[model samples]
Target: MHQDTVEKIEHALEGWPLLDSLPRECYGFHYRALCVPIDDRYDIFSYENAVIHKSVTAYYHEETHEYKLRMQVGFVEFCRIEYITNSLEIFGEKLSKELMQLLEDMVTFNPKNISSLVIKKGICDWAFAKELPETLEGYQLFIKPQQPVKINNGSYIIIDYVDFTHASDVTIYYNMYRDEFFGEARIHSIPDVTYDFDSNELVELQEKLEKHLVPRMREARQAADAAAHEGEA
Candidate 1:
């Protein structure tokens, strides 16, 4: 990480009282989670069961050369803001604006206050398949819509497809800020796979799963089942 990059990020975070005082760590421009105090006075209960009301983290990825800003308002609710830019000035400006908006939203945040219009538009645009055959590639496919998950300062509609027979699943969501479709898959044996597709390549998501991910998962699941039965015998 460059010194200028660090300084720029710190500058963007200037007015954020919660994050301003925290120190930055090395490994790859990162800040540990900053927990927000319970009230305007920044006071916290000293009990052992204190629940984290809100938290935020910001970091820069070396491989992607992108800055990621994440804020979690409550349990199971979060927003991710990302920026891929070489200009430190631009990064600072964008980060500052997003951080300010996120903090403002948190002042009166409600987990259930998601925008249905945003969700509907995202689904209409990104969903490659609303309904798939009950079975595909010898595995039972289960498909359904998920509650919108917050991302990039707005709600993102997600559709999930599960191969119950093979213990695998693929979740698809649209990144409005990036104008790209993102697919995340969990297979039985291999590490999780995440891919980003251009808006035009939406159909390729299904093709990739049917040709590659599903078969691999089937093979891994069958082998694991066989091993378990063998041990029982």
Candidate 2:
């Protein structure tokens, strides 16, 4: 990417909002779990056994009484599971930034040591429109069609937006049934490209988000709102 291109991306990303941290007394946590099976020694292992015999990584802050931990043992060295907390008690502070740091370090540190990678986060039992708004505000963050699949309860859809070469496309999952929306980005392998890895990664993300996702979201929200108003009139 050229310097001008890099500058453009950086400027656009600023338009997107940074996610807020979950309140200290959040109903529950939204976390990201990564799976990297460095070795396949524990093939065909029983799930029950793995649960019983788990490995744990924990961190505690005595001063603030902040405790964070994750427990899981590699099944015959077949899988290395780790979690980066999205929302937790970190001395009344949000752990998003810290979590992101951990993710970048772990993945890049030993890309070859891992076999598979997964990133997932959610707010369980969410309440729809009342809590999670349909309006998506940003430059070009939403996808077109804005279709939601109707279900027994309400509706939900996952929008695949943002491209980062080798990694999975960034996603925005919306659930009307649950009245919740989750945004997630995951990478299995680093892309072989030109721009600066450190500076350009987030910039690229912002560019795609602004270029594609935001506009679609705004359009959907407007249509939905208009329909609601027309029904009332």
Candidate 3:
């Protein structure tokens, strides 16, 4: 890979992952996963593959008020086969307004440290699909959390979809296991998600549904169009 290209890529990252090793599948593609540090951080990326290959969704525990960046990578055949946590919010000292803005990529942060990048396996979670996407669509969702889990991913449910066909909500179930800092998954609106595409790019109907998407869906549902609920997957 060209040093200049890597430098330019790093220049955009707020902070990169602590990579443990080059991913086995990174054989012929120019792909990267960046763990940025905005107030609500995300795992932003650019890839030759344009499907919803991987994604993340985060939730803050109000009682603790700490942030959790849930990480999920996708396989063509499976929904959430693997996951990892990037950072825990350290409400350390309040960052300067300038710094906070910088974190959100409102302003650029020097990615000169990009080449020194890494992808460490932080907290890891493995959830197998007990129910098929087609069948898990009823308001009833049952996921068997890992027994030795270190993080409470989410039992305090937040729903972004309320009206799609039972089959339409299956992707959301898979995205449930994705970590938020790696990449964002939202319900697609203009066009519904496609199954033949990669998971990363597969869903474009709506995305990052937790924040604005869910609220938008609620507002749209009042008009009797539950279609707003489908988002980035």
Better lDDT candidate (1, 3): 1
Clashing pairs in 2: 42-76, 128-179, 140-210, 140-213, 140-214, 140-215, 141-213, 141-214, 142-213, 142-214
Q: Could you list the CA RMSD of all candidates, in the order they appear?
A: 11.6, 22.5, 17.2
Each candidate's lDDT (Cα)? 0.46, 0.30, 0.27
What is residue 70's positional error in candidate 3, in angstroms?
2.2
Question: What is the lDDT for 131 in model 2?
Answer: 28
**Candidate 2 residue lDDT tens string, 9-57:** 3353344232233222221222322222213111111112222232323
Which stretches of candidate 1 lie above 4 Å from their native place? 1-122, 125-128, 133-148, 151-157, 163-168, 187-191, 196-213, 216-233
**Compared with the true structure, what per-residue lDDT tens digits does model 3 show for residues 80-191?**
1122222332211122112223222212223331111111111112222222232222322221221111113321111223333322221232222342222222232222
* Candidate 1 local lDDT, 27-53, one digit each (tens): 122344432222211111111111324
User: lDDT ranking from best to worst?
Assistant: 1, 2, 3
What TM-score would each prediction reach against the true structure? 0.34, 0.20, 0.23
lDDT minimum window of 10 residues, candidate 1: 41-50
Task: Highest lDDT: give the candidate number.
Answer: 1
